[model samples]
Target: MSKTALIFWGGWEGHTPARSANIVKEMLAGHGFDITLEQGTSVLTGSDISQFDLIVPMVTMSTIEKPELENLVAAVRGGTGLAGFHGTMGDSFRNETEYQFMVGGQWVSHPGNIIDYRIDIAKPDDPIVAGIGGFAYRSEQYYMHVDPSNEVLATTTFSGEHFETIAGVVMPVVWKRRYGKGRVFYSALGHTADEFDVPQMKTIFERGALWASR
Candidate 1:
């Protein structure tokens, strides 16, 4: 049976959630997933979220109703997968501690906003990053508060050019973890849909989504 995915996109327009949703929808569909694309977090309320194999939240810096947030958490705890990229996953629901805990990270800042940086594959043997070497890209280098339990797959060193205090700090750029019985994956890339045009970034997102799905 083909897997199902629900993609909720909307919140901060600066993130271009709509375009990102479309890109993800196409990618997931190509992988044989039945997609349900919706805007806003209302769709999560009282939904039988466990039925879907994967959930992708393209929302950024938004608030979700308590009951809806509870439902989404329950679903993941019950084995439904959750996967997303950039602030869509990491920087969302800023006020919700449980939500942040489930995601395993929260974006704190992006120093130097859209500057050139290098992403190093921390685990080259991992299938999600296999054959991909440390590559350079120009974008926001996300500084995040991450859970130590996260299995970090990739990282980037802070150049200290933007924020002198955090200079040389190695921050996680890609990671995967388990929230209860569900799998969770996140990448601090994809500030825009066009970022997906990069072969390595695209492949990482694609493979990470597949890996997170049930």
Candidate 2:
């Protein structure tokens, strides 16, 4: 049987969570994985969650119920892989403390929301980013306050024509961290549908999802 993947997407509409989640769900389906898509995290009951191999949160912002949040954290820690991009995974759950701990990072700011920037692949031999290159992107260069324990996979240095003294700062744009028996992968790309469709971005996102699964 094909592997099962659950995609929970909903929150503030500003981040375009539904669109991002659909892109990933379609890609995973193409890879022969059975995929389920949900509009919001509220629909995930504990029993409803136990049937999948992976849990993907395409949520951007909002309060997640404590029970739902615990179920999600437990699901991943108990061996279900979790992966997604931008605030959908990292900068999510503005009021849920446990949710933030489960994902391990949060988006603090993106100086100019959408502009061009360079993302450098730091670990070339890592399966997810092995052949990925330094690519130029036209999207938000995220300024995130991340967990120090995360294994940084790729980074983007901040520089732009709109500001001064914001140059030469390298922050993680992609990373992974272990939680119990599961694996978590996060990419800071995908600020827009077109951004997620970039060749390099698609490779990173697709490979990350496959790698994060149990």
Candidate 3:
């Protein structure tokens, strides 16, 4: 059966959310998802969110109103899966604790803005990450405040080169968790749509998105 998705994008321009939303829209469409792309969070209230099997929010650092926010939270709690990557998901809604709780993590810093790093596959057996090996990566090495209950799939180590205080710190790069009855997945990869050019990065996110919608 084909699944449906609602992808609402555009918050901070630096995130290039429009490009991100279009990219994921294509990716999911190829996987048999019926996608609806919209700008701004207002789409949440305008649409019957519960009918969609998945919801992808590509908005970063944006304020969502109480009604819109509550509507989204309610829809997901009733089993609409949520999934996204990088700041679009992790760094979104700084003031909403409930949103962060549902996401399982919030971005704190990227120690080294954009540098070469390596990702370690923590759960090689998990379907979302299985068969994918750790590879050299170039992106913001995200250091986040994460939910301890998350099922971490991948991680990165801080060398103290950028932020000396947190040297040797291991941070999650990809994770998935349950939000009520909905499956939630997030990755600190894809700082911009360009990052998807990396096969490993793209594969991880695509597979993870499918898993999230499960």
Candidate 4:
């Protein structure tokens, strides 16, 4: 059977959630996955989730309705893969406690957007990170609050540009976690559509999603 992917996008307009979802849908389609795109959290209800092989949430700054949120959680924990990027996955939910737990991280700050930083592909032997030549890009250097048990796949070193001097830290750029029987993968890149289109970032996302789905 052909694999299926579901994507729900919308929340705060500042992050351009729709554009992000489109990029993901296009990528997944190219790889032979049937894609379903929804615009709001309300769509999380239908029974169609069980038919999907993966779930991608692009929501970034809104309190999800409990029923809808629970359905999404159930879909994921029931073995449907979950994949997303940056605030759309983590660092979202202004104060929603459960949402943070599900995503496994929170974006605390980004002192300066695109201030020059270097992400080291930590899991160079892993298919997702392997062969990805380390490259520097001008984008938000995300400072994330990561879950302790997650398998960190990549990290970024402080480049001494804007916040590096004071906030000397190696932050997680890519990671994977297990939620019940399902797999979850997140990439802390994609601050913009252009960033999502970058060759390295696209490779990381595509590979990560395929890995998470397994």
Candidate 5:
């Protein structure tokens, strides 16, 4: 059976929510997904969202109503898969810590803003990042506060060039975790939709989302 995915995108235009959602839609469509792309968070204010096999929130740093958040939390906890990349998921819902709890991390800063860095596969045996070696990347090197329970798939070391105190710090770039019976996946890469052009980045993103599908 074809999997269904709901992508509700709207927030800061700087992050290119619409473009990212389009990219995701095309990618998943190629994989035989029936996708519904909505424009805002209003989609969640309704009844149940547990009908979709996956939920991808392309929104970044936006406010979600209490009841809306409650419904989303309940749906994910009830076995709906959740997946996203960079600020869309990690840095999204700035005031909603409960949403951050479900996402497993929150972006506090980018440290250097945008610079060249390398991402190392932390778990080479994990299918999400398997066979993919470390690769150089250019974008925001996210310094997030992450949950230790996450099954880290990739990591990147901070050079301390931007933030001295965090120098030599090892941060998770990709990870997967469980919320009740549902699977959640996140990646710190993809600062922009164009970042998906990188083979390694695209591969890991696609794999992680597929793995997160219920």
Candidate 6:
């Protein structure tokens, strides 16, 4: 049977959640996934969470109710997979510690806004990044507070041109981890759907989704 995936897209308009969701939906569908797209977090409060093999939250900086957040967390912990990119996952739910814990990271800042940077494949043996060498791209270099337990796959060094204090710090750009029995994947790329136009970014993001799905 084909794997099932649910994507919730909405919250901060600056992230262009709808456009990003469409891109994700198309890519996953091409990978033979059965995709369901929703507009808000209300779906998280419902009982249908168990039916999905994977969940993608394209929401940014949104508040989720306690019950809704609990249900979503339970679903993932019970073996449903979760995966997302950029602010949608890494920068979301500023006030929810549990949510941030499950995600394995939270975006603290993006120094220099959109700027040129290199992403190094830290774990070249990992399938999510295997065969792909470090590459340069122009986008937000996300400075995140990450869980040490995360199996980091890629990283980028801070140039300190924007924030002098964090200069030379190697930060995780892509990582995967387990929340209970479920797989979780996150990438700091994808500030816009257009970023995926880069072949390497597109490949890593798509593979990350597939790897995270149950």
- Which prediction has the highest TM-score against the true structure? 1
User: Which should have the higher TM-score, number 2 or number 3?
Assistant: 3
The list of candidate 2 runs beyond 4 A from truth reads: 46-48, 160-165
**RMSD to truth, every model:** 0.7, 1.6, 0.9, 1.7, 0.9, 0.8
Worst 10 residues of 3 by lDDT: 205-214
lDDT leader: 1
| Span of 10 residues, lowest total lDDT, candidate 5 | 40-49
Global fold similarity of model 4 (TM-score): 0.93
Give one digit per residue, the lDDT tens place, for model 6 in 77-112: 999999999999987799999999999999999989
TM-score of candidate 1 on Cα atoms, chains taken together: 0.99
Clashes in predicted model 1: 0
Pairs clashing in candidate 2? Answer: none
lDDT of 5 by residue, 1-214 (tens): 8999999998888889999999999999999999999988888876468888899999888888898889888888999999999998887799998999999999999977889999999999999998999999999999999999999999999999988898899999999999998999999998889998999999999999999999
Native-vs-model 5 lDDT?
Answer: 0.92
lDDT of 3 by residue, 1-214 (tens): 7999999997898989999899999999999999999999998899688888999999999999998989999988989999999999998899999999999999999876999999999999998888888999998899999999999999999999998999899999999999999999999999999999999999999988888784
lDDT of 2 at 131: 76
TM-score of 5: 0.98
Model 3 misplacement above 4 A: none
Query: What lDDT would each prediction earn against the true structure?
Result: 0.94, 0.83, 0.92, 0.83, 0.92, 0.93
Which of candidates 1 and 4 is the stronger one according to lDDT?
A: 1
The 10-residue segment of model 4 with minimum total lDDT is 159-168
Residue 149 of model 3, lDDT score: 98
